[model samples]
Target chain A: MRAPDLIRFARDAAAGNPLRTVLLVLAMSIGVASVVVLTALGDGARRYVVNEFSSLGTNLVIVLPGKSQTGGFNPGNAITNTPRDLTIDDAQALLRASAVRRVAPLAVGTSEISVGGKLREVMVAGTTAQYIDVRRLPLAQGRFLAEGDWRRGASEAVIGAKIRDELFGANPALGQLVRIGDRRFRIIGIMASTGQGLGMNTDELVLVPVSLAQAMFNSNTLFRVLVEANSRESIELAKSQATAILKARHEGEEDVTVITQDAVLATFDRLLGTLTLAVAGIAAISLAVAGILVMNVMLVSVTQRTSEIGLLKALGATGGTIRTAFLTEAAMLSLAGAVLGFLLGHAGAAIIRQLYPVYPAYPPDWAAIAGLGTALVTGILFGVLPARRAARLDPVESLAKR
Target chain B: MMNEPLIALSGVERVFQLGDSEVHALHQLDLRIDSGEYVAVMGPSGSGKSTLLNLLGLLDRPNAGTYRLEGRDVTTLSPEEQARVRSERIGFVFQSFHLVPRLTAAENIALPMVLAGTAPSERRKRVDQALKDYGLTNRAGHRPNELSGGQRQRVAIARATIMQPAVILADEPTGNLDRATGEEVMRLLEELNGKGVTLIVVTHDAALGARAQRQLRMEDGELRQDSRQCAPRT
Candidate 1:
């Protein structure tokens, strides 16, 4: 039969069974929608992780005294009770490597810092002036601490956007006195808002020179190091060289952990990719079930229209024609369902945007195409047996039945 | 009898298995029909009238027989070949009319041409003539449900005759119609016969049977009698 005639046949058949058509379309559409929405969510999470990593500066690597079981540089993994030691000496040795450009030894604590009567318990980071270069934060006010701050042990402080708000209430000028814990310091500058990075607010911290923080708190040991590569090209080399230097400094004991930005981002990438496949697998099960639904519907349709099949055969319609007519109905049902499902999937992604801190990402074009294609192919594949049964029905016996 | 018969069945036997018993629907029946002959098959309900008609129409195959259409052995033809023969040489009208309900009158009439891959222009020309000849031009756009029983039967007749086949087998074509409508349909079939189309009617109505120039009577699956009502005009 010609294309237009077959289409008309499909349209008439579907019109004849509106309730079945609607139900089958709805079922297949839901399968497509679930696939699209799931893939979009996975894409959204990937973007979220990338944005968070970019906020911390792409070339920076975070160093830990040792690895925690979680594989991150958590401060709670200190070796106070153990005899094994990893220290500021390792950070200095890593800095001496040719591939390394700049490094910041950060000592962080959540403590009370006061300016006049206003006091806030905020995160305090102790590092050097290069910490600003390694990170992308720029000074919005007075100058940050020079080498003098670390060498002379000057009590100088730089508060982030959120900390400056709570302490100084906006105008954080160069020459303001602030007390951090037990010692007094000068609020030299305010860092621009870096927004939320790595699932935490960077804008809510106060940063000070490492020596000043150590002197003020009466501690001689350095904190965990933040190492920076010379450029994007040297990142992997820098990571390896730094790991080697830290390894040598610890008498070849690989206690200190060196984690690059690439490694962290890639973990999330692999995790998200696998998660997407898992979700697709789950949706495939639903698609299989929907295909079975199509098979069942087609079987019932064939049984109910037995005499019509007989009549069509009697009318000199080829077996191929009869089979194609029924299969066309199934394919049209699934194709319509796929289109509706794609629309609903976009709506579902919009809902995800409202629920998440990050905006949901659009699913790739292939997702939509594959979603619809799968539905169409599945309908044809599953509708074949029933269509063949219809085509092969014995006209004499069929007419004799009723 | 010098002109060759359009259809011939020799020793045609049809058997069916009914659970544990074998029933013979047509028993060694021999029959011949010629072009332009109007014949009626009359029998009781279980007398194999429809079976003989079905075999002649190429809708069924005999268990043990030699059936020929236009001197060719049609009983040995493949099903597809038989379908081709039916499409080209025979037309059928059923008791229920068998008009596809979803199709319009014109579509139902055009279906045979469509199946045969007739050119659109030619189908249009022939369908227009069939519609006009059957007095169905006004009801061309109506579905089977929208048309009366008689109108639907007219559409069915138009469909059957659109190919202008040599033979038309009608299985009780007026069975569902009122007497007036039945007579009108019978007249149409007789008119086709007048135009040289071999017409075969299967009916239980003796009155309808009496209109045929020849009548074949059956009882208990056997051909009981064959009589000429009058000499068929050459």
Candidate 2:
């Protein structure tokens, strides 16, 4: 039999029963939409995190004060605390390395800075002259901390736009004093907004020369080291080189760790990818149920149209033709649902972007394709039994069923 | 009968199993229908008239018999083979005038040819001829529900005979129609029989049975009467 005729019959049958068709489509659309939306969010997050990490530069390696995994590392015949040594001294020593471009020892703590009568608690970061270069922070108004300022232990501070607004009005205070806890520091320049980086709003921070932060916060511990590679091509080499140098300086105590932007992003992507698949997998159960629903509906249709099927058979319709018609009906319904789901999911993604644009930035294409493909396959796979049942029906028995 | 038997059923027995209960619908029935013959099988309800028609039409199989159509035994053909045999050699008309509600009369008429993989041009040609032959040309574009009962039955007949099947099995062809409409349908079948197409009508109405050249009366799953009619005699 001609394929078009079977398709026409399937289309007509689906159209004839609007309520059932609509229900099946609705069920399938939810599955496809869920898969697409979750996948988009996860993939976008992976992309964003990778981009943020890349902004930190290639030659950079961060040293933490803890083990990468277990009990602890002993500085001896084995590796040393070099990777885990997150300290200002290591930051200083790294600066002396020939391969390293620049190193900035970073200390962060929260403090309430009061201006006149108003007060706001903001993140206070301490670093030296190359803080801007290593952290890749651009200046908005004033100059970043200089080597001279840090060497002289000057009480100079640079603030983000949000910090400037909270601590002081729009009036320029390029040379006014601001209190860090009880100590006073002269306001220098303001940093440009970098939106949100790794969930921290960069614009909500206050920056001071590392010396002033050390005196004000009353702590000498540096949480992380910021390093910069000279060129893009030597990023990994710079990272490894820095690790070796830091390890030797720290006496082989393996406490510090180095992570490239790509490595961090890969981890983030793997985690998010798993989460997306999990959500899509959970929604797949519902999709499978919807497929079963389609199968049941087709079964009912076959029973209801017993005599009609017999009539078609008597009119010379082959069994294959009958089976193809039902299968086509199911497949078309599934594909239609997938299409509707895709449109709805895109709309959903847009809404998320409008509401939380900073979070999910990119929607991956594979999710949409996978969702549609799964729905179509599910529809046909489940529809097979009913189609075969309809096809194998005896014309005599069917017509006589009445 | 000197004429060739286009349909022959020998020692046919059809039994149905209903929840551990066995019921015989056709019992050792032997029958022969000659080419171009117009015959009506009549019986009360449960008399196996429809069962015999089903067996002869290849819509079913007999457990204890041989059914030969055009000199070929078709009792043991596969389901697909049966469908092909039914499509090419057997036509069907029902009391409900079973025209697909969604299809136009022309599409219905061309269904058999389409299923048989006929070329589009040939299918169109044959469908057009059938529409003209059944006086349904004007109703070709109408769906089953859109046409009157008489017109719908005509379309059904057109569809059934489109492939020029050797045998036409009609079960209560006009049972749902009024007297005038029923007569019109009978006349159409008679006209086709005149064109050398063997026609078999299954009905309970003795008046309708009178129109055939031969009559077979079934009772309690058995062939109770075999009579030859000279002129529309019941």
Candidate 3:
């Protein structure tokens, strides 16, 4: 038969039994939609985490104090706590690197602050004037600590937004002399209400000069060093240069671990990419199931239409033509199901985006195409047995069945 | 070519395997049918009349011997070639009026041409002429279930003859109809035979068989009688 007539004949046969057609289509569509929606969710999670990490700062290289053992059973270096301490001078020495743009030596401690007849314990972060620039922080009111000698601090402090509200309420908090850990320091600035990053809430911490913070805590060891590279391409250079400079300053001891932001981002991307593929594999199982369903329904259809088949053979339809007709019917049903499933999956992804606007839940192009291709292949593969069975039926016997 | 028969079966033997036992359906049967001749095959149940009809329609293959149609040795032809011969030279009318229930009268009549890959314009023209000739023009759009038994049989006949085959095979064509409708169907078959199409009717009804110019009676997988009259009684 001609292609158009064959298609019409197959279409008519499928339409002849509406219930079976709908069931087969529904099975296939569900399989495809699951693959699409699951992949979208898996990939969406990867994007969300990568976005949060990228928002911290660009071209950042962090220096954690201690020499991490590459491979050994040494318990002392397991937690990366080496005996040698990273001091303020070691952080200052990193400034000599050509790729380093700004360096912030950090020191952290808990202190009780009494101001406006109110006393509260606050987490204190001590750093230089360049700390704001390196961390990309914004000031809500007044100025940050002034730029001066790194060795001597001018007894100035910066209060976080939460601390300012709790201690002063409606009162002006800028320039207030707040006694923190038995030392009186003038509040130089109030920080903007930025949320959390890597577990620390910027809104609730008190910022002070690193020199005074170390003296007040009776410790000479700096907490960490945050380095900002000149550009994205300079991050690796800045990291290696800072490590080498810090090693020389630490009396030739490699005592600090330098890590770039891109390495961490790449690790997360790979982990989530694998997760998306795993879920897609799980969803593909349903397509196989749908293929089997097509096979079962088609078998039943062949048995039920024995008389019709017999009539066609009696009317001079070759077995090959009969086989082609049945296969065409199967393909038509599968194609319809696949298209419906594609639309359903997109709608499902759209609903996910609507509910969680921050998440990008679009299915990848390869995944959508793969789902459609697999559905078609599975349907046709399972259809072969039934088509052959119909072709081999004895016309004389089948005609006598009625 | 003029002396040759339209269908010739010589030393044809058909065997059926029933479990481990073998049953002979047609025992070395020999028959010849000429073009435009009306013949009736009459026999009791299991006497091989149905087997003869099936063999004649090429629906079943003989285990031994040669069968020829239109001067071609058809028994040895490939299945595809046999289908082509069946499509072009043979037509079948079943006892139960086996019209596809899903299709309209018009589509059913166009089925043979459709299977042969006839062009749409030609199929439409021929189907229209068939519908008019069968007096089913008004019922062209109706399915088999919507038509009466006589109308359904008319649709089947129209489908059978749509290809204008050289021979028409009718197997108890009037078995499912009332007496009056049966006579009407017989008259239609006779009308086609009058127009020079070879007609073969397989029936057990003596009265129906008596209307044909030639009759072959079978018993025990063998022909018991072969008789021909000068003319079929009106």
lDDT of every model, 2 decimals:
0.80, 0.80, 0.90
Candidate 3 deviant stretches above 4 angstroms: A70-197, A201-238, A346-365, B230-234
Question: Looking at model 1, how many pairs of residues clash?
Answer: 0
Against the native complex, each candidate's DockQ, computed on alpha carbons, is 0.39, 0.59, 0.65
lDDT of 2 by residue, B1-234 (tens): 355478888998999998999899998888888888889999999998988887777777898988888778888787788888888888899888887777899987887887787888999888888888888888888888899998988888888888888889898999888999989999999888988889999999998898888999999899999998777422
Q: Per-prediction RMSD in angstroms?
A: 4.8, 4.7, 4.7
Local accuracy of candidate 2 as per-residue lDDT tens digits, A1-402: 777766777787888778988988998898788877877777777766766776665546565555566445353525442334355676777767666788777788888787787788888988888878777778898787767634346788888888887667777768878787887888888889887666455688878877677767776667777777676666687677777877787666545676665566668778877877777677677678878887888888889888888888877777888888888999999999999988888888888888886766445787788889989999999899999999989887787666
Please give, for residues B156-229, the per-residue lDDT of candidate 1 as tens digits: 88888988888899989999999999989988888888888999999999999998899999998999999987
Q: What would the per-residue lDDT of candidate 1 be over residues A1-402, giving only the tens digit for each residue?
A: 667777877888788888998899899989999888888877777777777787777687777776454444434335442423445455667778888888877776767888778888877887887788887677777777676434445787888888887766756446889878888888878887766677446688788887666665566555578788988889888988887887677655556677888888888888887777677667767777788899999899888888777766666666777889899988988888888998998888888887874654667576777787888889889999999898788766665543
Scanning candidate 3 chain B in windows of ten residues, the lowest lDDT window is: B225-234
Question: Which consecutive 10 residues in model 1 chain A have the weakest lDDT in total?
Answer: A74-83
Colliding residue pairs in candidate 3: none
Q: Which candidate should be chosen as best, given TM-score against the real structure? A: 1
TM-score of 3: 0.83
Docking class of 2: medium
Alpha carbon lDDT at B140, candidate 1: 86
Question: Can you give the lDDT of residue A302 in candidate 1?
Answer: 89
Report the CA-based lDDT of candidate 1 relative to the real structure.
0.80
**Candidate no. 1 TM-score:** 0.84
Clashing pairs in 1: none
Cα deviation of A316 in candidate 2 (Å)? 2.5
What CAPRI grade goes to candidate 3? medium
Query: After TM-score superposition, what is the CA distance of residue A297 in candidate 2 from its true location, in Å?
Result: 2.0
**Candidate 2: residue B52 Cα off by (Å):** 1.7
